[model samples]
Target: MKKLFSFLLLAFMVVNLAHAQQDPQALKILNQMSQKYKSMNAFKATFTQTLENPSAKVKETMQGDILVSGPKYRLAVSGQEIINDGKLMWTYLKDVNEVTITENDAEAESMSPSKIFDMYKKGYKYALAGTEKQGAETVDVIELAPEDRSNPIFKVRLYISQKDKTLKSWQMFRNNGNRYTYSINNFVANPTLASDTFSFNKAKYKGVSVVDLR
Candidate 1:
């Protein structure tokens, strides 16, 4: 489940440079959203994730929380906690009472939580899909298609709040007939986080097993 969550989250860390035929309106909205995120020093958010596979008739929902500060982040979901302090990553699995440590490689094309802020600068084609009313607020919808047809993901959709320029939800459509959705329920911007918030403390988990892959 941890690997699945990570894989799904990383799918959002994809984008491509703008093209001549790119939609200006979509780019404008994306830029605004990116700028708003970049201005934040630290943030915490509670979110819910849903995975549905219509062909297999499988559906599951999970709740999670994330704390991010620059390139460092801590993600907690479904009995697993992943912590990254820019250069190192620690994944603690509660079910097994084990923690795996590894080096953080940004060039690996894998997803990092920080990538969510500026993913629009990567290999994708995007356009403003439409607008909708969500409760009392209006939302701007954007759809993204990967430039590489071989990618497992077929499409990515983003729902941004027009009033606050914040992301409300995102969904990914996979070629395997599976869809993953993430909805932000609560967000606190510029939160005061401790210096060691992204670091893993081995002492706290007394008898936990440690596997260092770095």
Candidate 2:
């Protein structure tokens, strides 16, 4: 479930990298998408994640939601809730009524929700794979491959709406044959957020066990 959260939270947004080798068309679209998110104060969205492993004949789908504001975010999925308020992080398990706390490591932000919008700013090559009809919208398909071959996630594909330049969905291909697809079901740009939205309030979770790993 932690692995799933890593990729699920990354579906939020990404900024562009100035790579000369990147396809011009893809870079243009990426820059536009980045600008769209950079202009927002905060955003909230609901998504559906489908995990599939053909070899194991395993397939599962779940619904999730996320709220992001700068370096803070709150994500809920698969019976778990992860809250990061820039300086710290809390992971709560619903079934066990336990919450683990840890200091937010800045170094890992590139792969975490805080820096998801800049994940593609380095160590990746991207290109526009063309466009296709995704339900009612025509989406531009962009494919990205990590320059470092050893990365667990080998490739990623993003679908952005051609009409509004918003991300519709993304797919992550792992080296271990696990494929995860996240589709944005609903999106709200620049929603007003409460100050405590990103903080973990233990009081709300009655009888929740606290495990401080910081």
Candidate 3:
């Protein structure tokens, strides 16, 4: 009887230990930060995207407020507006005064990677990319490679904050040999939002026609 009890206890402990090792250290931290990224049903923040190619560097500085829910999102820059009400993605270029709408796909590929709350859960594999100290903070570097390498996005490296266990910045490598890097600064969390904010407003832009790209 004593021997049987000891064997069962050992088996239980072994199973728990195995489960603990399932997720890599970096992946575990990323998931925790994802909670903050996932908490707000809708939020608004300023976004700046800079694309660098070998020959030339294109920098686009656009400040926008974003409202996101489930798979739907609506983004409106200072003088521009974009809507994706789950079924269609609408982009209004204020400079050109053109509205482009694209049908939402099952894969949701139209959405940018930074919009992702859970990248690893979407079939991304992560590996440790060593640690580095920046000023007074220690940052953990992690590299994520996609299982399906079909698109221009080949791999991504995330520089995560060690103290807060949050992502600081990420660099995405493209197949064309050009890398895209994005750093999110001054992220604010706003949980209190209206449901209608994510919906499309056709009347607001009376003259703009929805250019269908489906």
Candidate 4:
């Protein structure tokens, strides 16, 4: 479950990257994000995730909130949660009551960056999908391709609201020949969130076993 959510999160990183200076007007607007995004070190947002399979069913709506600081962060969903402290990746499933801790040194986990700028430099293709005004602010719908996003995971797309350059929605393509959809319902940036909230307590689930994958 988390593995898929992580991928969905990674896809967002790709869309949030700064726009190339193809237009002076857009460049100036993109530059302004520098100041606005500083307070974005932390965000608390409710996510509605839908994972699909070919099992004659539809997507499952898993509600959750994510607290992130790039590689050092955590996401709580349903009754389970996943955490990363820049050193470890912990996944705890409340239903099964199992906790799996692993080293954070994974190719996928390393993609964690404070901003989208990191992803563009890592070889991602980006294009603009015109623009629309959300309320009083405008948004640029940008789409990304890894230039080699054929992993059967799915084709990824992103909506970057021009208002804040923040991602608004995302979708994933699964190899099961199914489509998994995910969206951010609301967001609160750099709110007064607690620090320990991102930590995992092994003792909290004494009945569950700890499986270290690293």
Candidate 5:
């Protein structure tokens, strides 16, 4: 679940491909997608995450929502709520009624939400995989591979709408044969956000145990 949440936080990585291995067509689409998201002041999105492991005969699905404003974000998924205020983070477990506070570690986050649309400037090689139909809309499929062979994620596939360049879905394939796919159901650009949106509100979670790890 932690791994799933981490990938969700990173989301999509796009833009600035100077590598010879990178495909020109893919770069153009990625740059456009990056600019589209970068132009937004804040956004809210609802998504569905699907996890599958054929060997283990396991399949699970969860619905979640996220609010992002620059480096700060609030995410609720799979019975867990994570709030990061750019400086600190509060992770609340719904079942246990516990919240753990820790200092935000940017270096530890390989791909932070704020930089999601442009983090592909290094450590990745991407190319245009092809095009496919997503529902009634046609989408351009872009495939991303990590330059570091040691990376657990062997490949990441992104489905971007050809008409608007909006991200429709993305899939991550791990070396262990576990596949994680996330589909964006709804997205609102530049939504009105409250002051406390990126911070955990203990008052709302009555009698919640606080574990300050900072």
Candidate 6:
């Protein structure tokens, strides 16, 4: 009985030790990338977003440009534009010539251009998945699983350039087996952006309908 008790205790200790050994390398790289992005005053990027679902046999791709300055951002896609001025958000639908205005809820976890950089800081367990070569650069792939299992998003994969510590791409895996991928084609750091770049000027769009949902 004594020998059996000692073996059980040893096994418990080993299990506890293994559980305590979380990888710090992945967290370090993510922190470095976040710091580099936070240091920049403003930036612009052209990106391609792809949504795919193998089970549903659906795939769609769209190209867009984003201008971000702090919490404010203007995202212009093919048929729509989203402008957030830190307090209010305006989503303009070019097809309908209408704009929906709503309050920008800061408490929500948004995957917008301004919030994407530091998104891994909360509600996630991240680890360095692996490394892969993309074109001429080697990228570090980090995998993040949401702590809340009930969350719609199951996993998020971030690809960071190993050379410049810049984010190359990120992919989101949804609970419904749908995946969304965003890849940056071009990036300009600390660009001379206008002060009103993030705001929606209603006068600019002549004869447009506005729907206020705020």
| Leading candidate by TM-score | 6
The clash numbers for all candidates, in the given order, read 5, 1, 0, 3, 0, 0
Q: What's the lDDT for residue 19 in model 1?
A: 35
Q: How many clashing pairs in candidate 1? A: 5
Better of 1 and 2 by lDDT: 1
lDDT of 5 by residue, 124-182 (tens): 89888789998999999988877776778777888999999888988888878799998
lDDT of 6: 0.85
Q: Which stretches of candidate 4 lie over 4 Å from their true place?
A: 1-38, 52-57, 110-118, 132-138, 193-195
Put down candidate 2 lDDT per residue, 193-213, tens digits, no spaces.
886899888889999999999
Candidate 5 deviates by what RMSD? 7.1
In candidate 3, which residue pairs get closer than 3 Å at backbone N, Cα or C atoms, i.e. clash?
A: none
TM-score for predicted model 4 compared with the true structure: 0.70
* Candidate 2 global lDDT: 0.83
Report how far residue 12 has shifted in candidate 1, in Å: 22
Residues 1-214 of candidate 1: C-alpha lDDT, one tens digit per residue: 9868876775544443223257899999999998888899988999999999966999999999999888889999999999998899999999999999999988552446677656656867888879998788899998887677787876788899999899898888888979999989999999988767999988889899999999
lDDT of 4 by residue, 1-214 (tens): 9878986895675444323333344344444543455546676678787877646576577887777664466778788888888777788988888899888775675234333423433445555546776465566655445544554443455545665667665565555657656577888887775657666776667888789888
User: For model 6, which pairs clash?
Assistant: none
lDDT of each candidate versus the true structure: 0.84, 0.83, 0.64, 0.62, 0.84, 0.85
Count: clashes, candidate 6: 0
Alpha-carbon shift of residue 204 in model 4 (angstroms): 3.1
Report how far residue 67 has shifted in candidate 4, in Å.
Answer: 0.5
Ranking 1 against 6 by TM-score, winner: 6
- The window of 10 residues in a row where model 6 has the poorest summed lDDT is 13-22
**Where is model 3 poorest over a 10-residue stretch in terms of lDDT?**
13-22
lDDT of 5: 0.84
TM-scores across all candidates?
0.87, 0.87, 0.71, 0.70, 0.87, 0.88
